[model samples]
Target: MNGDLNERSTGRQRVLVIDDEPAIRETLDTFLSWEGYEVATAESGEAAVKQAKEEQFDLAITDLRMPGMAGDETVAALKRLHPNLPVIVVTGYASDEAAMRCSKEGAIRIVRKPVQLEDLLSLVKAALG
Candidate 1:
C-alpha cells in the first residue's frame, strides 16, 4: 500500500516486492512488513517502475520471470530510475546465464524462489544496513 511507501521518512526502510503471483506478493509483503520494514508490492515490472519513479525504496526483491518486462529488464529500468537502488533477483530457474544476466543488470543478488525467509532477512539487513 502507498501508506508504507509514504512512511519512508519515519525510519522504516522501504522495500519493494515485485512478482506476478498474488500469493508470492502477499507472502513477501506480510513477512517484510512483520519484520519492521515498509513493504510495497507490484504485480509486474511496469508497475514496479511506476512506483520507483514516485517513491523511494532501499531495496527491491523481484521475481526473475513474469508476464511482461522480465526481471532482468526490470532491474535495468529500476537502476535507471535510482542508480544505486539495490535489487535482489528471485527466480525459480537460476541458471548460470540468468544469474549472470541479473548480475550484469545491476542486481545485488539472486535468490531462488521458494525463498527462505531467514536467509532473505539476512540479505535484506546486509543490504539496507
Candidate 2:
C-alpha cells in the first residue's frame, strides 16, 4: 500500500492537492477540509511526489503546467509510486493533447480551472470510491 501512515488516524481519505497557485491550493485545502477529507498541498510536481513518498493518499489533484514537472509527468510518476492511486488533472488550459497525455499517464479525470467545488467534490467522491 502507501507504506508510511498507510492507515491514517482520522479514517478520512487523504488527498494530495498539487498546484502552483497558492490561492487554488489553499482554496481546495479549505474546501476539502471542510468536507471532512484530510488534504495536503504541494506547489510543484516534485514536491507532491516527495510528500507521496512519506505519506499515502487516496486521491491527487494536480495542475497541468507547473514550473518544474508537468502534470502528465507528475501523473506518471505518481502512478509509478502508487499504481492504484487515482489522479485528477485541473488546468486553466486544456488542449486535446493535454487531455490525451493525462489519460495516457493515468489520470482518471481532467477538471478545467476555475474549479467548481461541487463538481470537484463529485469527482473526488467518485475517484475515492
Per-residue alpha-carbon lDDT of candidate 2 for residues 39-110, written as tens digits (9 for 90 to 100): 999999999999988888999999999998999999999999999999999999999999899999999999
Per-residue lDDT value at 103 in model 1: 97
The sequence of per-residue lDDT tens digits that candidate 1 reaches over residues 11-86 is: 8899999999999999999999999998999999999999988888899999999998999999999999989999
Candidate maximizing TM-score: 2
* Model 2 stretches with alpha carbons more than 4 Å out: 1-7
Cα deviation of 16 in candidate 2 (Å)? Answer: 0.1
> Whose lDDT is greatest here?
2
Poorest 10 consecutive residues by lDDT, candidate 2: 1-10
Q: Please list the C-alpha lDDT of all candidates, in the order they appear.
A: 0.92, 0.94
